[model samples]
Target: MRIAYRVETVRAAEQELIARLPDGALMQRAAAGLAAATAGMLGRVYGARVVVLAGSGDNGGDALYAGARLARRGAGVSAVLLAPDRAHPDGLAAFLRAGGRVADDPYDVLAAADLVLDGITGIGGHGGLRPDAVPVARAARGSNALVVAVDLPSGIEADSGEVLGEALHADATVTFGAYKPGLLVDPAHAYTGAVRLVDIGLEPHLPSVPDCEALQHADVAQLLPVPTGESDKYRRGVVGIVAGSARYPGAAVLAVAGALHGGAGAVRYVGPAADDVIARFPETLVSAGPPAKAGRVQAWVVGPGLGDAPGVEEVLAADVPVLVDADGLRGLDPAVVRDRAAPTLLTPHAGEAAALLGVSRAEVESARLRSVRELADRYGATVLLKGSTTLVADPGGRAPVRVNPTGTSWLATAGSGDVLSGLAGSLLAAGLTARDAGSVAAYLHGLSARHAANGAPLTASSVASSLTNAWRDVYA
Candidate 1:
């Protein structure tokens, strides 16, 4: 698993580590890692052109010191001082001693640079770039050089993952000490290309719990349901699905398809599309009327094309874990969900999430981390904010938010979310907590989509059918 800490936690840890080390030792550690990363990107440090976009603080110092190291290796290193008087004094002296020259014109050197170290702003800088630095930041991005951001991509809210106003775009980001939340979550995550973490001996000082966590294959393998000798159709767990309408029966088909592969012992589907579902998947237990009349089930999945459905309230009243999605998510009573004895998982895309929050879609998209957490807190349920980056946030903000790393843009096809809703709901039936069910389902859902597509267009059915491959890939 990959864990990310908040800015405050990381800063506290850095300060503690710095106090224990000799004077200037901490900065030297960062500079050495930064220099090594730069060299690796450049391949041949000798006869290469390197430019440092230096600002006014320790972040700028890291760049200047790195530039000095490059200069010693015979790279023609130049510094573009956004704050000439405010640049790191010791770092500047060291750069000059190593034959690094301050650039007469920022644009001139950036145009010919082989690599640009973006140290204009650090984790502390937020609300975008200063007015004076915007043009140079743009020029560096427009250049052919590989832009490597120090710590963060600058102008991103390190804690909230919001990219306000203007921020520099990097080809890669070399972060030190610990991973910050901004590097892992979008929309700031989009600005940070590939991220490389440099250890500066701050791990021992940091807390165990992180702000957010991204699960890997091995982590997910442990969570997958494996049937034991005592396990049967009922013992493995049964998932009840209340989905589809007379108008849209395809949703029922797709949802059942996903649930069938979701490690559930049996799927009891109760809706208007029973005939359609039974026709597609004959093994499904079909029924009419409310969810309570569908026999016993460990969990319920409500609303995926359930237009003006009447079964949502009935499912909510049950003492089993419930997953609400699509049309079922509309007009949800926060008090009802909050007071429930069983866990509830809410899956909503940007538009659906916005409607629930009573905000605009753009607002939710811009601040995804905040939006997911807010939705989770408001309803007192687990929220899976589905988009380019799928985030599952637990209620009350006690545990770290889980980010799905396997998401593919190809999973944007219609009805894909319905498939995800069923898969997650089935996991809920299989005894996974709301948080675990949502995150694990998202991980597999994304991986399955990638397997089905393989760089081509894929339908929601293809994603559902590829679950076996995804499972094998995980177990392998």
Candidate 2:
């Protein structure tokens, strides 16, 4: 599994590695790797015009020393020090001795550079580019040449994946140690185009527990539940869905739409909208009572379009893995959730999240990672906060939080979330842990949305129809 430690953990590992190595060995390793990556981007280091936007920390030192390597290779390299007095003395000397020029007028060389290296900030940075680094970053953005970030894109919160201020948009970023969460999440991820890890022997010291993780193709494939030849229909898994009402009977259909195709052996739907659900999906076994009264099921999905129904209490009290969404979020009590005997996953949008936190929607959106974690802790369940970038956090905090990378903003349409609830619920029924089910379902749901629309406007049914292709992709 790919792991991403927090900044503090990464620093501890770095310090341990640095102390064991000979003098300046760690810096040399980082710089050499950076220089090599830059050369690859430029096609040829010799005679290439390269500019380094150096900061005050080791990040700047990495850039400056890398520039020295380029100078030794006959590249016309220059350093524009943001903090001239605080620049690394050894790096500056090495660059100057290797024929690299130091210019305090930042924009002079950056405007005409063939490539720009952003070393303005590192993982330690909490806010945007310092006032002076702005112009040089802007110049790099406007320039036609390639822009490469030394460690991570400047002006992004390395730990939280939040964009603090105006960030430099990099064509590619060469990161040391391991992948930071910001590089995988959105907003900040948008600024970080492509990320390449430069192995500097830091993995052995990194903590096994990652702060967050992004699923790769192989990882997703492994997590997906596969049916075996020996397994019978009942042995696979059965899902019971408690959703929809007369006013929103379509939600019941959509939820069943996802559940029937989502690898579930059988689906038992219980709600007032049984007629509509049966009309759309006659295969579903519709019950007239609540979920607990419904027949056997490996897992349950509660709340999509439930609309303050009186029977929700019975559904919420079931003794199986349960997924809560939409109307299920209304006036929820932590005590009721905390008392549950099984794992529960709560899926909420910003508005529902804001309601849970008793804060404004903007506050929840502003700090989505924090909000998701707080909600998980407060409700004592797995929380999936849906937005431009969906986040999944487990209440136990054992697994690293998952940030979905494949999603389209067009998925904001009605009934999309209902389908997500069904997909995730079915996965939970199929015997994956709540965390795995939620994240994997979200991955598939987002991919289906992308496939259904392919840049065109799409309805919720169209998204559900495309799930077959997405499932095939995971298996492939």
Candidate 3:
């Protein structure tokens, strides 16, 4: 697992190493790694034009020191000092001694450079680029040079992955110590093109668990439950779905359609659209009463196209793990969710999440990590914020946030979310914890959507059908 420590933690670790080792040793290691990375990019360091966008912190120090290494190798290295007065004295001295030049004009340097190293900000920065640094950032973006961020791209919140202000888009980001959360998540992630972790021997000092984690194929496959020879239908786990209404039969069918592919032993669907659900999926056990009366289910998925229906209250009253999505999230009773005996999961897109918080959709989108955590804390449940980067946060605060990386814009089709609700609910029924269930289902759902689309338009049914292949791919 790739663990990402908080900035403070990383700072502490750096200090500890510095205290033990010789002074400036760690920075030199970081600088050397960066020089090697940049050299590889230029093919040959000699005669290569390299520009380092230097800031006031150790990030700039790293860039300058790396520039010195390149200069020693006969490269034409220039530093665009964002804060020349506050720059690291040792780094500046080393660069000057190695025959590096300081660029008076950032645009001129960017125009002629083969590669640009963004050292303007590291994990310490909170907001976007400072006003003085903005022009250089823009110039790098528009230039022909291949931009590489030294630690993290400036103007991005390293912890939350939110782009605070104007950010430089990097062709590749060479991060030190460990993978920061921002590089793996969205908004900021979009600017961080390709991320490479330059191990500076800091992992042992970091936490065992990360602030958030993105699943790999093996991790997802391991988390997926498999049936035993003696397992019966009920033993495998039963998923109870309460969805649809007279006005939205398709919602019920789509939800059940996803549930059918779940490794669950059986699916018991209860709601007003029982007849329609049965018509589409004859394999489902359809019932006409409340979810509690539907009898023995490991998990319950409520509210797809529930349409202000009367039965939602009944389903919400169930003791089993419940997943609320779509219309079910509309004017949801926080008390009902908070008081539930079993774990509850809420899957809401930005619009629905905005409604829950009484905030604008743009606000929710801007700070998605904070929004998901806030929602999970407020409702005392798990929240899966569905969007460009789906984030799953647990209320208990025991685990790191799970960011869904295998998502595609094609998954934006109608009824796609209903399928996710069912898939996650089934995972809950199969005995995974709320956090695991939500994250696992998201991974599978995203993979299924990609498989179904395959660069073409797809419907809800196709996504459901693609689950088998998705599952096989995970196992394979």
Number of clashing residue pairs in every model?
Answer: 0, 0, 0
Best model per TM-score = 1
The TM-score obtained by model 2 is 0.94
Model 2 agreement with the true structure over 170-251: per-residue lDDT tens digits: 9999999888877776667778878888899998998777889877667888988888998866677899998888899889
If both were scored by TM-score, which would come out higher, candidate 1 or candidate 3?
A: 1
lDDT of 3 at 220: 91
Measured on C-alpha atoms, candidate 3 has an lDDT of 0.88
Q: Please, what is the whole-model Cα lDDT of each candidate in the order they appear?
A: 0.94, 0.87, 0.88
TM-score list, all predictions = 0.98, 0.94, 0.95
Worst 10-residue lDDT window, candidate 2: 308-317
Best by lDDT: 1
Where does the lowest 10-residue lDDT sum fall in candidate 3? Answer: 1-10
- The segments of candidate 2 whose C-alpha lies over 4 angstroms from its true place after superposition are none
Of 2 and 3, the candidate ranking higher by lDDT: 3
lDDT of 3 by residue, 160-197 (tens): 88997888899999999988788877888899887888
lDDT of 1 by residue, 1-476 (tens): 88999888988998898889899999999999999998999999999999999999999999999999999999999999999999999999999999999999999999999999999998899899999999999999999999999999978888888999899999999999888888888889999999999988988998989999999999999999999999998888899999999888889888999899998999999999999999989999999977888899999999999999799999999999999999999999999999999999999999999999999999999999999999999999999999988999997889999999896888989999999988998899999999999999999999999999999999999999999999999999
Give the range of the ten consecutive residues with the poorest summed lDDT in model 1.
154-163
